[model samples]
Target: MRGTIHVLNGPNLNLLGEREPAIYGHDTLADVEAMCRAEADAAGYALEFRQTNAEHEMVDWIQAARKDAAGIVINPAAFSYAAYPVLDALKLCDCPIVEVHISNIHRREAEWRSKSIMTQVVTGIVSGLGVHGYALAVRHIAEVRGRTK
Candidate 1:
């Protein structure tokens, strides 16, 4: 079966546009979804977009993607630092995984914020490119799955 690409967002990301305009930017989560949907459509693939403030819910979605999705584009947000369960679920994906960050975590103030446990399993990472990163990630997933023209 042709599968869908899951675009998942983590904790506090629900606050996108209003959270931290200087870092996260002025585009809301809805804006990001529109961008991802457009890219997924342009690439001829179905999209499954979701955001969660709870870690278990995020883990549940990742596990669900194992069977339902072709690939994943995730912005783990605050969970990036030490979500071992999330990392474990990601390890079972058996498909391309792209980790995206709206702001450059490396340039952020906190040292711990710069590290991501999921990085070891992700196929690619897009950072500091703002909301455009999500679209790039969808394109990359499409390319990896040979779904792009």
Candidate 2:
């Protein structure tokens, strides 16, 4: 099998470093993308980096991953707690899936943070570690790859 991964981001995350620096930290989205690409490469994996502010686009990408990739890492951002469409697409894929969040949703205000509709479909979730969550999720993906070895 090809050890490929698709990193998908959604809704306003393009403003990473500057968007609420207290919550999202100082790493820009491009900065994090570079980190993810390098980390995936180090883990012997190929990557497909994608980002969109539209929920439908993210859903479409996840649906496409069903036949096109080996693993998936998504930072659905505000959509995580509200995106049933994204969850629906994830449920269609058999590949290993991980969700990423730059902030700890559960610790935030009830209205500002909410439960993930897609959590049940993911093998694991990484959040609140800021940009490092991406690389850490990559390691977890590598570990899953390790087990199947």
Candidate 3:
């Protein structure tokens, strides 16, 4: 099987290094992309790393991944709460999907923060590990892909 991993980010993740450094850490989205690239490359998998603030774009990417990607690692950001479209699109994907969060949403102040609509469709989740979570998510998909091969 072809090994192509799609790493998708949503919403304010573009402001990573500058947006709430205390909670999300100081790594920029570029930094996270680089980490995911390295991990994917090390495992001999091609990577498609992307981020968007728009929910429609995220849904489009997830839809594309259903046919073109071997696995996916997504950080749905604010959309994790109630973006049923994204979740519905994710349901179409047969490949493994891993959800990542730069911070532990479970420990956040708001109860809504702990709930992720994506949780039902993803293969697994990586949370609270800072930027390294992206790398770990990629690594997991790589491992799963390897096993299938």
> Tell me, what's the RMSD of every candidate?
1.7, 1.6, 1.1
Model 3 residue runs over 4 Å out of place are none
| Candidate 3, position 148, lDDT | 87
Candidate that scores best on lDDT: 3
Q: Tens digits of per-residue lDDT for model 1 on 2-55?
A: 569999999998999999899889999999999999989887789999999899
Q: For each candidate in the order shown, give its overall lDDT on alpha carbons.
A: 0.91, 0.84, 0.92
The TM-score leader among the candidates is 3
Candidate 2's displacement at residue 28, Å, is 0.4
Model 2 pairs in collision: none
lDDT ranking of the models: 3, 1, 2
Q: What TM-score, to 2 decimals, does candidate 1 have?
A: 0.95
Q: Write the per-residue lDDT of candidate 3 for residues 1-149, one digit (tens) a residue.
A: 25689999999999999999999988899999999989888899889999999999999999988976889999999999999999999999989999999889999999999999999999999999999999999998898888988
Which whole-number lDDT from 0 to 100 does residue 98 have in model 3? 93
**lDDT, candidate 2, 1-149, per-residue tens:** 34788899988988888888987888898998899888888888898888899998898888878875768999988788878988889888887899998887778878546588778899899978878998888777877876886
Better of 1 and 3 by lDDT: 3
